[model samples]
Target: MTALLAAWCLCCSLAFASSYPLIKSKPNDTGSNLLHEGHNNTGMADRCSDRGFNAITLDDKGVMYYFRDQYVWKGYIGPAELINDTWPEVPVPVDAAFRIHHRNKPEVHERMFLFKGNKAWAYYENKLEPGYPKLITDVFPGVPGDLDSALECPAGECKSDSVLFFKGKSVYTYDLSDPSAVKERQWPLVQNCTAAVRWLGKHYCFQDTMFTRFNPVTGEVHPGYPLDTRDYFISCPGRGHGHETRRNATLMSIKNRCSNRSFEAFTSDDSGKTYGFRGGWYFRMDSKRDGWHAWSIGSTWKGLKGTVDAAFNWENKMYFIQGSQVTIFLSDQIYSMVQGYPKPLQDELGMQQVDAAFTCPHSSDLYIIKGNTLSLVDLKNTPRVPGQESSIIHSNVDSAMCNSQGVHIFTGASFHRYKDPNELLQAKELPEARNIAAEFLDCTQ
Candidate 1:
């Protein structure tokens, strides 16, 4: 059985190299070709046929379209599935496609370029632009004639180039600038792969039934990779063979980013629901619901029109903390602000200038954070009285929240947890809670 298993592994590894005709001629002695490089050969052929998505591209409106041989699935960043039951076929079977959204150039709308063999087609507003299906050599000067996959990066995140094109076993980059030059460069170590996508600030290479994440800056595959393809995309074996049915939830929403304003947005979470505010914008994340819904703070919470610096829920009441002002409203009252509210923290708790706040999941104490300091506000204490119990517990807190697990605090990129309110938050539940907070609260407005 051991010998048979070894033979099977070798066969699958060879099949991986042989499956891509474009990469067959390349030498296999490079460090990127080591065993456990991208994906194991086992069950790869079966999984490959299951993934009906052949190509993917993002539209001008930020809608991602996943192309199959016959149908195109489109939707916003999250909850994207097939659209228009009767979709038109591409001029040619596409090996890859990407949209060019000129952010700086407002006059130029988005244009989708579909690539196949040595030719490409440009489309605008879903209509074929005039004089398209141009030769790759003529349109994309310096780019290789054939491409297995391609992805574009927004201007802010891309290091050397805005567009990355993959062919055979190597990668090329197009700066998307004047003179239009393509550089033969490699990072995150590209090897045998079927497709690739740029998500957040990292690169993902997909092959067969597995996927691996690489830190483009480090030129190394990040630890804990070669993940199952199903975790990121719909895994349906034999679904793409022929007469494939429509697949929903084909892509994970985490791949999408919200906005920059959420770098340190005020946030609160309860019963799996998270509410966040940045400036006058507010977004609520109902884990039970679909995508996030963005609303103006004034519209969502009447009489509130400033950045929410801190917030929490206590006794079914929602608290909005902005600077030294603390406003209270009934959790059930989604519209009007509470009467005789909007009191100053200095007058109530003797604490001023709160930054972020949350209630302890296990106790009655309300945790308020300001800069790096944390103050435990005892809810059981009487208000307007000097004996109101509140103490400074810790310093250097970036954010704090109470969930069912314990008291979670964010300092720097680390997340510390304490199951008991009286205990110190010693366990590092999350390595980087700041980033997680961004995603959990839909911080990107």
Candidate 2:
């Protein structure tokens, strides 16, 4: 009886420890009193209203806005004046959002993308454009939906039209320069990142009441952050704040149950060798080998460290993808990385990090798979312009390899094949080719 009571007490303490304090100000605390509750009374809005806001983003005009439930509160730069009570007719609850400065040569305009679940709405001056709230896959192509946070990241080689979206530990960058290419970066795992914003050139990520400032260029957290958010934005109490307290509590409880998540950061090469890596730690493995051989990524792999998110083989050469950077390796050696090699993938093939890739043995045509779409890369052709082709493969591909037998694709635990009839007919004629095909299947399966 005593042990049971003690366990109960400890569990209660842990629950209490995870709870964030409600840091709302009184009714007449600050800002203009033009606040009004949204008319849309969905269950999601109730929970979001109780939590105050899910995210806060800054516009190109330097105006900051807080998004909660279906309502939006626009504020100015200094003194934090409320531009409008419930500004912008936000149709639904927002999961993650970012503002974009769409510029195509002579024409330039401000655009906002609001994401909710798998759908996203493109807004211009608070008005939804024609055929909006489309599937995020349709708009962003390779980016996965249901993002936790997003920000307009305009730094480094990324064009002014690029935006970064976060889902768990992975960061997906989509540039308007070429909508087909989607860059990815594996970041340290963070939980419940409620909001993110850029102020004074540095990015600040928020998890409930705490905030962390990150350097956009270095991708490192700046010193003096994870501080109380009250130090930055003033909390103001308004309508719909009190009515959804219970609903907020329920959502928080649900989050506690479903929020425990773990993801892998690894890649594989064409030779059936899987490499497990995270940050600086790395390990290489082969089915023929006994076990994983752990090694220091920086020392062993040289320029190709744990930053590699995807890898593939084409014409005896290996391609490594890290964000927009691509590193090449010759089939013969693994000691030193090729110099002047970590160039942008966009420059070569006009596509970003691919999900899966395989080269056709007969034609030497490289198939680059990103999301559910596929692009054929004919290396023989100069001045590559990526053209899309119809494919039966789905998104979230695991790996792909091609040999004398056929093209094998893996998505999760399932395996698929796209056999070229011409190659099969030709292979039957040559005895050596048949043996090679059998060996290739043995290595892959």
RMSD of each: 19.5, 24.7
What would the C-alpha RMSD of candidate 1 be, to one decimal place?
19.5
User: What lDDT score is found at residue 54 in candidate 1?
Assistant: 52
lDDT of 1 at 336: 46
For model 1, what is the alpha-carbon lDDT of residue 117?
82
lDDT of 1 by residue, 304-382 (tens): 6666766777666677777788887665413346788898878766677765677754356776666544457677687
Top candidate, metric TM-score: 1
Q: Rate the local accuracy (lDDT) of all candidates.
A: 0.49, 0.49
The lDDT, on a scale of 0 to 1, for candidate 1 is 0.49
Per-residue lDDT of candidate 2, residues 41-113 (tens digit): 3333322222535677644333456666555544411122222232343445678777664556223245666
Q: After superposition, how far is residue 208 of candidate 2 from its true place, in Å?
A: 1.4
TM-score of 1: 0.44
Clashing pairs in 2: none
